[model samples]
Target: MGGFEDREKAFEAKYARDEEVAFRVTARRNRLLGQWAAAQMKLTPEETEAYAKSVVQADFEEAGDEDVVRKLVGDLTAAGIAIDESTVRVAIEEMAAEARRQFMEAK
Candidate 1:
């Protein structure tokens, strides 16, 4: 764990090959996101998983709408990926506005 990049590479390799470790890590990440979102919403950590799951699923499966963005940002505290919620929000909002404009123009 102390070897920095080497450790991270090792962990990634393990994650690629070890289902158990992957699952444990995934659950831990979810727990982290849940805790973060729960704090934002003033809820308990125990009460956060459902929300986190919903948010995570929406981000992956939905149309990338405001709800998806809101939920994603609200709960994405433990994400290893470096993304800023404000940037995501702005991008989504721009897309939504452009979609609306195009739809209206076509009518």
Candidate 2:
């Protein structure tokens, strides 16, 4: 019983850590995606930083990535940048990879 309890606690701890890492990676990806979009829209440096933060916040609007995608697509279109959902999706994938790489390098 003690061995089983210890194993369960260890698993729980690993799960918590993994969840934290995933959240951080997603936030980093969102920030990178925002920077990319800001560059596409030719935003100023200050504006770009703010936009990246906003993008990170956008993730909290829902459980999945749709909220972020919708925001980016709508904002980019409103800014007169020709972009589509698929393009943004690709950017998200690329940013996710970059974010993961960054975390790995930091490790």
Root-mean-square deviation of each candidate, in angstroms? Answer: 17.2, 0.5
lDDT of 1 by residue, 6-69 (tens): 9899988887767764344443444445455555566665567676566445544544355565
lDDT of 2 at 103: 87
lDDT of model 1 at residue 99? 47
Q: lDDT (CA) for every model shown? A: 0.55, 0.98
lDDT (Cα) of model 1 = 0.55
Worst lDDT window (10 residues) for model 2?
98-107
* Candidate 1 displacement at residue 19 in angstroms: 2.9
Model 2 Cα shift for residue 97 (angstroms):
0.4
* TM-score of each model, paired residue for residue: 0.35, 0.99
Score candidate 2 by lDDT: 0.98
Give the best candidate by TM-score.
2
Give the clashing residue pairs of candidate 2, or none: none
Each model's backbone clash number? 0, 0
